[model samples]
Target chain A: MSRDENAAGRTMLEVDRLAKRLGEFSISNVSFTIDEGEYFVLLGASGTGKTVLLETLTGVIQPDSGRVVLAGRDITRERMQRRKLGIVFQDQALFPHMSVGRNIAYGPASSGMKRSDIEKLVESLASGMGIGHLLDRGPATLSSGEAQRSALARALAMGPDCLLLDEPLSSLDSGARVEIRTLLKKLNRGGMTMLHVTHDYEEAVALATKIGIMENGTVVQVDTPQRILTHPGSEFVARFVGIRNVYRGRLRRESDGTSLFESGSEAPFRLETLCEAIEGEATAVVRSEDVTLSAYRPDTSARNLFEGTVSEIVPARRGAEVTIDAGAMIVAMVTERSVEALGLERGNRVFASIKASAVRIIEG
Target chain B: MIISRIEPMHLIFAALGGALLLFIVAPLAGMFLNVGKAELSEAAADPEVTGSIRLTLLSSMGATLIAAIGAVPFAWILARKDFPFKRLVNGIVDLPIVIPHSAAGIALLGVLAPGTPVGSLGERLGVTFIGGIAGIMAAMAFVSIPFLVNAARDGFAAVPVRLEQAALNLGASPLRVFLTISVPMAWRSIISGLVLMWARGMSEFGAVLIIAYHPMITPVLIYERFGAFGLKYARPVTVLFVAVCLVFFLALRMIAGRRSHVEG
Candidate 1:
């Protein structure tokens, strides 16, 4: 809902309600904008219109509906040639017939630059992308990280209005993924307006200034990564951001005027909720990380505490996520060191407590 | 688990191809062995034989040029488009390849000999296919059309459509993309096709024999000499043609290697 399209210059790219169909798959009613020098990320699962959205921006595809406005000009009708948007495909799609220098120079040549200027620009970009050593080499000889950087260099050399990348790091190993992602960050830092798309939640959280979550071709929510993850408007957005604890529950007005909620657990839990309890029941949700794991009862004014067994530990990069089995399922994160310190293991009894403030209630 | 001995199928295929190779190569060996210095000198000394060779090269080049021009566009279309009766059109393009060379010759004669509207129109345009260079080119182009078109089509097909889309996104016109990306990417295939079309056109005989026997291309000359003076006299020209073709074939192979290296 927050649109800051007006910068010192005109809007770089504005997509208005774009719709496209191929086979039974349809991408409909999609609209978004990326301002000058803004880093916008489209995050979704595979086949969720991320690539189609990028293509629609690049003019490789003509949407069945909607107009694409770039720099205050309607580019929906412009041929792909005239649109001048650069894209890095998931597959590098490098021109195998061309050497790295020639590949980078392709864009400048198409832009009608002089040959010497193109050569000079290519040299500069190659150096900047750290591929100057490979300028004479073929694209096949480059590693995935190197190829992605070359792709980035090729797109940048074209002097595009904006960059559209379709999950450029998805194919790479973790190390390569980190490397390409850093390169993308550097591009954004140096004033390249980019629409980077990915299916990875953490990658979007790391690289995006603004993130849009799309489902079935419609963008359901667009916000900062924290807002989408912590305060998701719907169960769909919450689950998509990997929040593991969402419960359909009934809210009862207790004697003290506090809300008591039972989520099909053995006992009802109490929480402060803004949603009216006049409706017999509502939805209660909590993020997995919002629940804190402890060896004993967490003594706090904070609301809910439950005794449970440490059921499983799912390994993650930053730490191990502890899944505790109470009357209701609960998840909490503890560092691997903490897991050891607390002697947390499967079937070992533990206590989990979630702050009342962290509990979110939704009316559906 | 390796069976080193030749399998029955292998032996059968080897025998079949060996017999075919023998049929093709024995005559070359026999023809050269039979021709002495006098036969060679006589074949070389004859002004008509040299003239026929020269005319054959010139018109073969002409036919290749025409085929290249037509085949590039036809190949692009065939590689890119889908339409009703597409397979039939593809089959038509390939017809000359399977038709007996003499059958091709009769077909060319039927189409281009001064009777049909095409032949009359050609006459009106001051083009004659009988007893002239024009007739040799027509026959050669007819037989070689499939070779060029099919090769170039495969080349174009080998290029990903995404590359063209990428070029277009980078702001090159459709024509520019074809010239800059599509054609260049497939240039190896196109060149191979051109070479094939050229060689097939160069060796055209039965078709040329039927349509224009008087303007003697090397093949027609070879046939005439074989009929008139027997094997010894025709042998020198046959060996000369083989040498010329070998030189070009080797050159083509080298160029292909160089291109692969460059692409790599």
Candidate 2:
């Protein structure tokens, strides 16, 4: 590839096949991008290199093999200070020596803004962050929520091209976390392109426009919130997305080109398979909402009816969750109305119905 | 989880610590008790004592200024970078603080005395150490440097690198972040370190004694009075000097403490 074309190919922020080996544990061959104003969330468990990727983007740790392009410019060789990225750390690092006013004024003043303008901007930002009264107060006096707000306001005061948050809410209590998450969502709506790293699935669902699920050293799947939760690309994604009935089976394509997945065990329910699997051992991801319980076998040509005893009935969001042991674990999300109508109880026998299209197949 | 107020053990420790404090405070009491108005007037008229006090303040303050300027960059490196020989550098900072003051004095003399390479090299630059003001400053600086570096290092380290990165992301340069976020957040430690370094420089004796005996600082002056004349000759000066340093330290502490508490 010619250098110009390759350079043009770089997105607003493109990480080209990045890899960093630090002793035994390292990230490799990870690549992704963010647009000028996209809310990209890199979500993963602790120690999965999510923060590592964010740091690499910020030039904290230089990647060994990948190029980082920002706004169509090759910033691979650029120092961290030149990146013009705003970041909020987990601890809400505030300057102890500077008051709220001075802290907000810091970036603009240092960036060569006029002193009078900086003062005005500082006052406006302090009030905008709900700390106008505390402008004269020092950072050490602020509460955790207040401190995080100040940290965020200070970062935003610089008017960065891109913003990064390293688990800003990870350290807060539940109430503070919710408050911050809402604040972040509000900021995101106002055109702040952000790369937020978090280990919470709920947080990811709440704040992310697009989700990047990282495992080990690579992004296993990057998808919209609905796609990742409902149609995960791999078993790893399915498990993390809380899919209860994941059936590992073999694909049996018939002469008519119709596909059926023959799962292992004596009472495997036969159903038409929607997507072909990579290997003979295919996987199916089924969310609780996709499954339904039947008192008797219904008339359907799909051939996916199974008799199993109700194992457990539990509560979910505005609904009741019923677990049916139909050869495989079938978690059905029934509204409280249906739960009452069915009079569902543990050890009661019922037929479970799930259409093939509802089953998202993953190739091994 | 156990959220009771200060425990009995804490009270006991505080009482014992208070007694130990009195042990240190008793000398000041004696200095006040022994001093008459006549002695204070006589000591005030002694030009040698005044000159020594003036020189001591100048050299100590000068040493603190050197530490203040030199430590910022080095402290940032020590706080942020991971490199070979870092621990060795940190250990080097602790050497003068831990070693006997006389050893540090001798070390400074060996390096800065005329005929030594450093001494002759500095002399070529129109600077001399032996019996000179530069030697006094060097001795004081060598003894007090650790406080500055340590305080500054801890201050910078306490600042999350993420804040600086955030500043950079916002298009501010690295220097901008250091000046804006990192330095301000860490300023208390730096200021406290300066106070400590300045006070240490003021009290420095052994190191100053070996390098520049002629430019007598207050401590050395006190030693001279005790040997040549006696306590009656030195007690008044000692009381006055201690009182001045006490006021300085107390004021600086209150300001730094208030500022930090407000920020935090």
Candidate 3:
């Protein structure tokens, strides 16, 4: 592949077919390349080998097979101290015995940098992390957010070419989560390359430039965040990314230049969709937010409408999730105000409408 | 002010516990109270008594320092690694603590006698284990090393592994990680272990008596005085030794406690 194909410059790290077996859970034949200045996020559920992969990349856990190339050098055999890759763990893992300044300065001190230079670097990095005032405090005294920032500062003090973060914001409260998310975005804007792993889809949406969906032990899909959300490549990817209405169907071309999707053989719920692919088995998905709920049907341009009873109304953040059993299970996310206006409740008859363009087709 | 919080059961338990405490404190207090200032001064001025006390302190310190150099690393390994028969190695470390000190002395002699490999090799280097300071240290260390090893091991185990891994990722070599992170984090436990080992070695009687009686450490000197001159002469020396030990032990413990507090 040409180096310029990546949005950033040359690739900063290339993990080729890395494999490691740790008892029963093993990551096998995993490969990905992170370009310079690109914020690549590996999105996966827990127990999917995300942290193991990150540990392998950092040389904390050696891979059984494959090469780890960093900045044009093959460092598969290098020791963790020689690899120059910085990592922030989920728990922050700050040195409890050291003051915040000394913790940040640990990396440079280990490299035998002069004390004056180390202090200057620690100060600069701490200020950049917005934690300069916390320098004299011990790590145990800091809050979770402060500890995370200190960990990040410590990692950055080494001047690593690429930073590997494992769920950097998973342990923070929602407020701190947003703060750190903005901080990460600002860091990326300053031309820092990062490879972050997280399970939260919202976090991936907020921070990732490129997303790699992992399952079991392998990368199932790698694409831009927009594409991963709009067009998931697999059934697992579709369900994992919160595309709520995924159905296996057969697509057939109609004479009027559109396609008809027939879902099941028994009742055969059919819907009109926009697709140019030849007739074949496929999967259709629609985001829950795209499904609109109404108390009564009215004249509209939407192509698919079904009458069903509300099976569940679960309150969510800023909205309620309405599940309707319209011959097929469908979920719609509506704001609390909308729910109140429509007088929605369980067992209430409702109409679920979807535009033809909102239906996404994935080939089987 | 404090009596209002004390319940009837609390008073009963407190009386029982205080009685036990008095049982331990009354003897030591009586020994000191019985010794007149003149007798104390005389005992302090005695060359043999002072020499034996100095020898006891120095040799025990030597034994603790020497044992720690080997024991600390062994403790770290035991804490961090998972080798086959690790339990067996751990059991062997605790064996000295469980076995009688006289049995420990016999075991040491079995290996360090004149014709034995260790003893002859040492003799070639102009060192002997029997009736020498080295023998005293060996016996003292043999019985006291378990304290250091066990305490340091617990200390190292309490240090989170992620902290060490974080240091390694920050470009520290394994040795540097151990020295900067592991050792410093476990400093309290290691210091406690050293104090325990030093104190245990200082009071050792059976092992040192059988191994090297001639060195005349304070314990041996006390025994000789008790047997040769009865309680009259031994009481003053015992009071002097106990007083010195209490001062140093309290000072060392205070240092350890204050250091931990400051670091925390």
Candidate 4:
């Protein structure tokens, strides 16, 4: 709930009770605010109305009800051309009939800017996007990354108060994704307000100052990325943000002034936690990356430790996910070097260590 | 394993396709061969023959231009919008293609004959339709307009709607988007449709016969020559007319091809 200090407490765009119905899928009572200089990302899975919400904000789709105020102007009923909001689509819908330079200059030309000024604007924007040499080339000839850079330049040509991006990086390969992500971060750092929509949680974590989690066509939770990752508001949010270890358990206060948590059902296990909740049933969430693995047990400050067999080793983003079966299943993320150093393999006996503070508690 | 060799079915398909191609080529080849250079020269020199050919091209061109003024925008609507009776309207656009040509002329007569309100208004406005060039154009457009409308609709349909939306979001008005983005992207298809409509109109027989038989287009003149003077007279005009039509068709096609590549 706390805003980043760079947000400056000034709202650039606000959506109030926005409602839209397209056939059977409808988003209702959606409300959020994006401050100036903030990169707000709306994160959700497919079919969650992320693109629809983005298009509605861009004035491509009119809401059945509610108000959209942008830069202190009410634009609920404004036409798309007058809204002054720019969007970069997932496919990078550049005008194929025009060269990259003309594509970038389309907005400026439409506003009746001088031809020389428009050319200068196109050059400066293209160079900043690292596409300076591609201005005279057609969009069909460019690679996916270059096309996206051209699209971003086109959207930024008019120097609008805010920009909306609709799954811009979803269609790119990994290299292009990283390149565009870096470009987006650079733009945010230069004080450009942006609202990006994507299903990639890693993308949100890397780029957003504030993240809004949407579910079933509604904005369910909005907070800083750090808070949303460590302190999810609901079980769905926790699972969505990739909290790999979640258990339904009961909390008990130990005589030694620590909390002892015991899970229920088959494969029941107990762990020491730092939860302040009264002795009752609760949920515990632990991130996979927070768990450490070792071949032999040693004295450490981590309060909870379990000896189990390594059940599976799966490759992940820059690491191997090692699934350990203690009393209950626990997944730990370790680098490839660590996997080799610890001689990890399937059915290898291993010890998993987790700090008490790493165990997050969510009460029902 | 995948079969890489040609099968019996492939030979059968080739034979059937070749037979159809020969059927189309035989009559035109026979007419061209039978017409001596002297006969062709005679037909070309005849003012009546030359005037009718000129009239045919000019009237078809006029019909195409007049129809396109409205058809392009109407095609955009058909491609982009969903409205009540849209299916019905689409079916109606294709009605002329399936209906009997004489029946279409009769239908046109019901609304545009001299005694009808539209024809009477046209007469008062110095634009008579019955037995005039206007009547020929009306009949030609009535029969061939579907080609243009359908082609333009398909052309507009193939243009991604997202591009237009992007243009609108970039601060271009709707009218500007249509002029600069939609029409240019769909230009080749529209041109192809126009050429097809013009060619179809030029060859129309029954409708023009019913509406304006006096101001003879090439088809009507050929029909008249055949009915009166038999095979020898008709063959020369037919060969010459086909040659001229082929030349113009190829030229238009080349132009359309070049424009698409340049714009694309």
Q: Give a tens-digit lDDT track for model 1, residues B1-264.
A: 998887899999999999999999997787667767776777677888888877877787799898787789889989988899999999999999889988988877887888898889999999987777898998899998898899999999989998988877777778888998889889888888887888888888888888888878999888888899987667888877676677877898799769866765
Question: Positional deviation of A127 in candidate 2, in angstroms?
Answer: 7.9
- CAPRI-style class, candidate 3: medium
Judge candidate 1 at residue B105 and give its lDDT. Answer: 83
**TM-score to native of every candidate shown:** 0.78, 0.73, 0.80, 0.82
TM-score of chain B of each: 0.87, 0.91, 0.95, 0.98
lDDT of 3 by residue, A1-364 (tens): 3466656378998888889999878898888888889999999999999988988888878899998999989988899998878998889999887899999999999999999999999999999999999999998998888888999999999989899889999899867876787788888889889999999876776678899999999888989875787567986897799777767678988889998888965766777889665577666777899999999995779999999999999887769889999988888989999999999989999999999888877643
lDDT of 1 by residue, A147-243 (tens): 8888889988878888988888887877788678778888888988888888977677767878889888878788876567655766677668767
Off by over 4 Å in 2: A1-10, A23-25, A35-37, A94-105, A114-157, A168-192, A206-209, A243-292, A295-364, B1-22, B98-100, B120-128
Instruction: Please report the candidate that would top TM-score against the real structure.
Output: 4
Q: Give the per-residue lDDT of model 4 (tens digit) for A42-144.
A: 9998888887788888887889998899988999999899887889999999999999999999999998899999999999999999999999999999999
For each candidate, the alpha-carbon lDDT, in order, equals: 0.81, 0.80, 0.89, 0.90
Tens digits of per-residue lDDT, candidate 2, A167-251, equal 8998788677767777887787787788888887656765777888999988888887656775678767766777666565666
Model 4: CA > 4 A from native: A1-7, A244-286, A289-364, B1-4
Pairwise lDDT winner, candidates 2 and 4: 4
Ranking of all candidate structures by their DockQ, best first = 3, 4, 1, 2
Residue pairs that clash (backbone atoms under 3 angstroms), model 4: none
Models sorted by lDDT, best on top: 4, 3, 1, 2
Deviation of model 1 at A228, angstroms: 1.7
Candidate with the larger DockQ of 3 and 4: 3
Interface RMSD of each: 1.4, 2.9, 0.9, 0.8
